[model samples]
Structure formats: structure tokens, C-alpha cells
Target: MNTADFIKARAAALGFDVCRFASASEPWSAGERLAHFVEAGRHGDMGWMETTLERRAHPTSMWAEAKTAVVLGLNYGPGHDPLPEMGDASAGYISVYARGDDYHEVIKGRLKTLAGQIAARTGEDVKVFVDTAPLMEKPLAQRAGVGWQGKHTNLLSRTRGNWLFLGVILTAAELEPDAPESEHCGACTACLDVCPTQAFPAPFQLDARRCLSYLTIEFAGPWPVEFRKATGSRIYGCDDCLAICPWNKFAVASHESRVQAREGLVSPRLADLAALDDAAFRALFSKSPVKRIGRDRFVRNVLYAIGNSGDADLIEAARALLDDPAPVVRGGAVWALSRLMDDEAFAALRSERAGGEADASVRVEWAADQA
Candidate 1:
């Protein structure tokens, strides 16, 4: 077998479900799409996308030595349907990928190992990236025949569907490139129809500001208010549009042990998550990606979910957080209590809390609740 074939075999041996190569100089339109996306303000708070455009748009621009691009996919298809639990308002819906070990952690070492193997076989410089770098993995994956970007703007195929993690290996070796995959979406609008916030502006365009994944995971501080109720109980990342994809029927459950859902993270109780202090939050999420959001941010999301829960039993949890030191968390608490409590009780709590609150943002949240 040649170098490319050897690498594909090695990737399969290393647990990758699909491995394909694309020429580093392969022409693509991701640059134009990205520029337009950023210029249109669709990227929201993700300013990094703008800064990384030079390298992300074109592979050769990032590194002139980059000759072969290897895009690998690891299946993380959920064992069971996630829609039912997502439907339960009292339960917080953590996206399926995040319920397990962090993909960056799980996939990084493997990529490095594979990179080392490639280096040993062929004397060439290499860089392995697992979603950290600016390199556009989905576009590269599409160019490499691994998958196509679905209507949700996530990499998906009939084989891996929407539940796959991508890792890219840029090498100096000149490997034969594979034929790219064509779009299979046909006239399907399942993903488009399922978005609670209508994030997609058109067939392939996505407005990240209105995306649940962006609001719950990427966007900092409090949510945009208008999208909070539309977010439902999604405390972490979201999977609504992805779950609605028709190609998912062919997906196989992830075989990797580390990708399996952790005990309580799949769909946690809103009240329990709402009560987590910083220490408890850190201890629970340790190596998980959810830890990156920090206790305050995570709790803020929980409060939004609790308010939307319509579960009167969770009122005490929301009320207990009215005095939270983190203004963002307290702001979310104000919103939740306003939704769960009657006007008289909510008014009294708001009156007591408003005098001492320092953050103008939180104060605005408190005042808004009165209206």
C-alpha cells in the first residue's frame, strides 16, 4: 500500500470510522462563506473566526509546506434517542457530545500518536488539530469525502449522520486525494424546521447569534432574552436540529468508551444543577467541556432553563439564587423567579435584592422583570 492507504488503515486501526485525504492546495469557497458570515454579523461573539480567516480559508496560506490534508471522523452517535429527555422541561438538556469525556481530550492524544507514526514513516513536518485551530474541519472533511455540511451547518453523512467528531492532520507528504462527497439533502427541511430560534437564514447559512449552541455554549454573559424561552431547557449545548436530521437512521452508536454518556450529565435535573456552587460544579465537571463555562455561566444557563421549566417545585431553587454574588447568575435567577413566582412574591424579592445589586446589567434584568 502507498503512504495514503497506509494512513487510512492506521486511522481505522486507531478507531477512526472514516479517513480521507484532500490536496492541501484544493480550491474551496469556505473563505468567501466565512468572510460573508463574519461581515453579516452572523458570527456573533466569535471574533476568533475573523482573525483566523487567513489560514482557515486556504490550507496553503496557513503553511506553504502543507501538501496533504487528512480529515478523520470519529463516530459519537448517541446510543438512544435524545429527543424525549430534551422534551422534559424540568430536566436540563446537555448536548450528547458533551455528556461524555471532552472530545478534545479523547481525540488529541490519538491524533498526536498518528502524527508521530506518519512522521516516523515519512520524514515530514506535521500538525494535528482537534477543533482548536482555525482550520475549517467541516469544509476540509467535505473536500476529503468524509462528509458533507448538512442544512444545520454541521458535518454529516448517511454513514456517520450528525454525530461525529472531526480531527485534522496536515502533513508535508503528498498523498493522493479522495473524491469529494456530493450533497444528499435533496429537498429535506427537517433540520431547518426543527430550529427553535430559526437560526438558518437560508439553505446553508446559519446565524450563530440565534443558534442555541452559540447562546448556551459560546456566547458570554447573559443570553439575548428573546432567545431564552426558545432555548427550552438546553443548559449546555443543543442538538435539536441535528437530532431532526433524516440521515441519522443509518448511524451506529459510538464504540469509543470515553464518548459514552456519563451518569448524570445526559439530562440533569434543573433544580439540582441550579443549586451547584462553584466547588461542586468544578468537582462534577472536572475534565468535561462543560467546566470551561465556569460555575457562574453554567448556573446562569440553568436558571434560564428553570424559569422555562414551568415546574413550580423548582421555585425555591430559583429564589435561593436571588442573592448570588455573580451578577449573571443573579440576573438569570431574577428572570426565573419572575417566570415561576406570582407578582406579589416576585415584587418583594426584587425590592429586597435591587438595592444591593452592583452590576448595571443585572439591575436592568431586575427592572425588566417588573414590566
Candidate 2:
């Protein structure tokens, strides 16, 4: 077998679902698209995208010697559609990709192992990248024919559907490139229509400011009032676009045990989640991607879900957090109380608690709810 074939076989043996090669040094329009996205301020609070623009523009921009990109994909498809889980208004809906172990930790070591083997065989310098680095894995994966970027702006595989996690190995050795996949979305607007916040400005563009995943995971402050009600019970991430894809019909359940959803994370009770202290949060999400958001932000998300729950049974849970240490959490609790309590009760509670609140943002939440 040739070098590219050998690399694909090794990746398969390492548990990757698909492996393909592309010219990393090739000029592509992806960088320009990214630049447009950032310049338009669609990247929201992810300031890092603007900070690393030069390096992230292309693979060769990061490493001048990056000749071939060996793109690897691992399928993490939930055996069934997870969209229906949102019907239980009292439970939180975590995005499917985050329901399992962190993909970075799961895929990084394997990419390193494959990189080491490739270097030994070709005597070429190599670097491995999971989603962490400035490298754009989706464009590389598409150029390598691993998948096409669907209208959701996520890589979608004909075989693996919308459920693949991507990793890339950039090598100095030039390998035969695979045929790039063409867009197959074909008049389908399912993904765009499914977004609660209508985050997508157009078919393939996203405004992260309105994205629940961005708000729940990356943004560190209280969400705008407009998005608070739209968030519904999604505490961590949103998968409505991915789960609604027609391509997913061809996808199979993932064989890898580590990427499957943990029982506790799937459709977790909003009230129970709101009651977790930092210690319990760390223990529950140990080794899980949810832990990266930290207990404060995670619980803040939970309180939003509690507010949207309309269960009133969870009122005590939200009330209990009114004095929590994190200002974000306190703000979220205020929002929850506003949603779940009646006019007289909310006004009384606001009168009682709003005066002593020191945080400006939390104060704003109270003031906003009063209006």
C-alpha cells in the first residue's frame, strides 16, 4: 500500500471512523469566509478568532511546511434522535456531542499515536490537532472528502452523517489528496428553521450571539432578555440543527463506548441540576466536556431552564440560588423567579431582594424583569 493508504489503515485501527488526505498547503476560500465572519462581528464573544486570524487563515500559515493534511473523523451519533427529549420542559437538553466525554481528550492521544507512526515511516516533521488549536478542521475534513459542511456550517458526512468529531494531522510529506465532497443540502432548510433563536443569518452563516451553545458554554455573563425565553431547557448546548438533518438517516449508532451519552447527563432534571454545589458538579462531570464551563456557568444555565420549565415546583430551587456566590448564577436566579412567579409575588420578592443586590448585572436583570 502507498503512504496515504497506510495512514488510513492505521487511523482505522486506532478507532477512527474515517480517514482522508488533503493538500494543506493548497489555497482555499475558507480563510476568507472566516475573515468575513469575524469582520462582520458574527463570532460574538469568541475574541480568540480575531486574535489568531493570521495563523488560522490556512494550514501553511501556521506551519509553512504543512504539505498534507490527514483528516480523521470519529462518529459519535446518538443511536436515536435526541430532539424529542426537549419535550420534557422540566429537564435540560444538552447537545449530543457534549453528552459524552470531551472529544478533544478522546481524539488527541490517538492523533498523536498516528502522527508518531507517520513520522517514523516518512521521516517528516508532523503536528497533531484536535479542535483545540487555531487550525480549522472542518474545512480540512471537507477538502479531504471526510464530509461536506452542511448548511448548519458543521461538517456532515454522507456515511457518518452529522455526528462525526474531527481531528487533523499536518505532515511535511505530500500524500495523494482525495476528491473533495460537494454540498448536498439541496434546498433543505431544516437546520435553519429548527434554530430557536434563528442564529443562522443565511443558509451557512451563524451569528454566535444568538446561538444557545455559545451563550451556555462561552459567554460568561447573563444572557439578553430576548434569548432567555428562547433558550427553553437547553442548559449546555443546542443540537436542533444537527439532529434535524436528513443525512442522519444514513448514520449508524457509534460503536465507541466513550462517546456515548452518560445516563446522568441525558435529559437531567432541571431542579436537581439547579441544586448542585460546586463539589457535586465537579464530581458529576468529571472527565466530561460539561465541566469546562465550570459549576457557576453550568448552574446559571440550569436556572434558565428552571424558569422556562413553568413547573413552579422548581421555585424553591431558583429561590435557593438567589444568594449564590456567582453573580451570573444570582442573575439567572432572578430571571427564573421572574418567569415562574406571579406579578404580586415577583414584585414582593423583587422589593425584598433587589435592594441588597450589589452586582450591577444582577441588578439589571431585576430591573429588566420589572419592566
Candidate 3:
């Protein structure tokens, strides 16, 4: 068997759903598109994208000797559309990928094991990478025939749909590259149309500043007034575009148990999540991706959800956060209370509390305009 065939076999044994090869040295336009995205300031507050622009342009830009890219994908599909979860305004809607254990933790060890086997068999230097690295896995995945980048700017596969978690193994060995996947998204606007924030600028482009996923995850501080209400009950990442894809019809639930939804994460109550202290937050998301945002930001997101919930029972939960040490959390509380409380009652509470707020931004949240 050829080297590519051997690697695919080993990757399957290691539990990867799809394995394909691509020329790491080949020139691709993904870099130019990313540069444009950053240049247009569409990357939002993610300064790391600008900082690593040079190294992230191509696989060879980071490792000059990387001749081949062994792209592997793991299916993490939820078996059904998670969009329906948003209907439960009292519960927080976490992105499906983050409902389980962190994908990095789940996929990294398997990637390393596969890389080691390839190294042993081919006598080649290999480096394994998950999404944490500078390597742009999606473009490489497309070049390797694993999937195509859909209009939503996410990798989509005919068989796996929008639910694949990707990892890459860059090696010095020269393997024949697989046929690249082409654009299968024809006249489909479901992903573009479904965004609550209207994050898409045009087809195949995203303005991250307006994306709820970015606002809930990568962004810190109290979100813009406009997005706070639009956030609905999404306390973490938003999955509207991913869940709305037509290709998902062929996708099945993930076979990997570790990637399945956890006991309380699927559609957790907003009140329960809003009550999480720092210690409790750490414990609840011990091995999950949600822990990275830290307790304050996560609670801030929960507060936004609470504001949009229209559930008056959660008023006490928001009221309790008024004195939170984190300015952002306190700010979020103010917004939540404004929505849940009557005008006169909210005015009385604001008059009592707004003067004492030390943070400038939190004080703004207490202003009449916010209510």
C-alpha cells in the first residue's frame, strides 16, 4: 500500500472519521482571504489573528519542511438540530460542540498517537496540531478532500456536514495529495439568513464584530446594547449557522462518547448558570471548552440571556449580581434588571446603586438609555 493509504488506515484505527492528504507546500488563497478579513478589521477583538498573520498564511510558512498535510476529522454531530433549544428562553443555549468535553482535549491525544505511528513507519519528522495552533486546518481540510468551506465560512462535508472537529499532522514525507473538495453549497442562504445578529456581510464573508459566537466567546466586557437582546439565551457560542446547514441531513450522532453532550450542559437553566460562583464554574466546566472564558465573562453572558428571557423569577438572580466584583458582571446585571423590572422599580434601584458603581462602563449600563 502507498504511504497515504497506510496513514488513512492508522488514522481510522485511532478513531478519526475521515483522513486525507494534501500538499502542504502548495500555494492557496486562504491566506489572502484571512489577510483581507483582518485588514478589514472583521476579526474583531481577536488581536492574535493580526499578530500571527505571517506564520498562519500557509503550513509551510510555519514549517518550511512540511511537504504533506495529513488532515483528520472527527464527527461530533448531535444527531438532531440543536436550533430548537433556543425556544426554551429559560435555559441557556450552549453551542453543540461545547456541550461536551473540550474538543482539543478529546482530539489532541489521538492526533499525537497517529502522528507518532506515521513517524515510526515513514522515518519522517511530524508535528501534530489542533485548532489551538497557527495552522489553518479548514483550508487544508478542503484541499485534502475532507470538506469544503461553506458560505458560512465553516468547513462542510457531504457525509459529515458541519459537525466535524478537525486536526492536522504536518510531515516532511511526500505523499500523493487527495482530490480537493469543491463548493457544494449552491444557492443556500439558510446559514446567512438564520443569524440573529445578521453577522454575515455577504455570501462567504463574516463580520465577527456582529457575530454572537464571537460576542459570547472571544469577546470580553459587556456586549453592545443591540447584541445583548439578540443574544437570546445563548450563554456560550452560537450555533445557528451550523445547525441550519442542509448537508447535516446525512450526518449522524458522534460515535465518540467523549464528544457527546454532558449531563447538565445541553440546555441548562439560566437561573442555575447565573448562580455559579468562580469555584462552581470551574467544577462544572472542568474538562469543557466553556471554562476558558472564566466565570465573570460566562456570567455576563448568562445575565444577557436572563435579560432576554422575560422570566421575572430570575430577577433575584440578576439582582444578586449587582455587587459582583467584576465590572462586566455588574454591568450585565444592570441590563438584566432593567429588562425584568418595571420602570419605576428599576429607576428606584438604579438611583440607589448607580452612584456607587466605580467602573465607567458599568455606570453606562445603568444609564436611562440602557433601560
Lowest lDDT block of 10, candidate 3: 362-371
- Runs in model 2 with CA error above 4 Å? none
TM-score of each: 0.97, 0.98, 0.99
Cα error of candidate 3 at position 208, Å: 0.9
lDDT of 3 by residue, 1-371 (tens): 87778889989998999999999998999999999999999999999999999999999999999999999999999999999988999999999999889999999999999999999989999999999879999999999999999999999999998999999999999999999999999998999999999999998999999999999999987788999989999999999999999999999999999999999998899999999999999999999999999999999999999999999999999999999999999989999999999999999998887579888988888884764
Residue-level lDDT for 211 in candidate 3: 97
Once fitted onto the true fold, the runs of candidate 1 whose alpha carbons sit more than 4 angstroms away are 369-371
Backbone Cα, N, C clashes tallied per candidate: 0, 0, 0
Task: Select the stronger candidate by lDDT from 2 and 3.
Answer: 3
Count of backbone collisions within predicted model 2: 0
Number of the candidate with higher lDDT, 1 or 2: 2
What are the Cα lDDT values of the candidates?
Answer: 0.88, 0.92, 0.93
Clash pairs detected, candidate 2: none
Residue 306's lDDT within candidate 2 is 89
Query: 193-283, model 1: which lDDT tens digit per residue?
Result: 9899999999889999999889888888888777888888988888988888888888889999898898999778998998899999999
lDDT of 3: 0.93
If ranked by lDDT, best first, what sequence of candidates would result? 3, 2, 1
Against the true structure, candidate 2 reaches a TM-score of: 0.98
Residue 279 C-alpha lDDT in model 3:
100
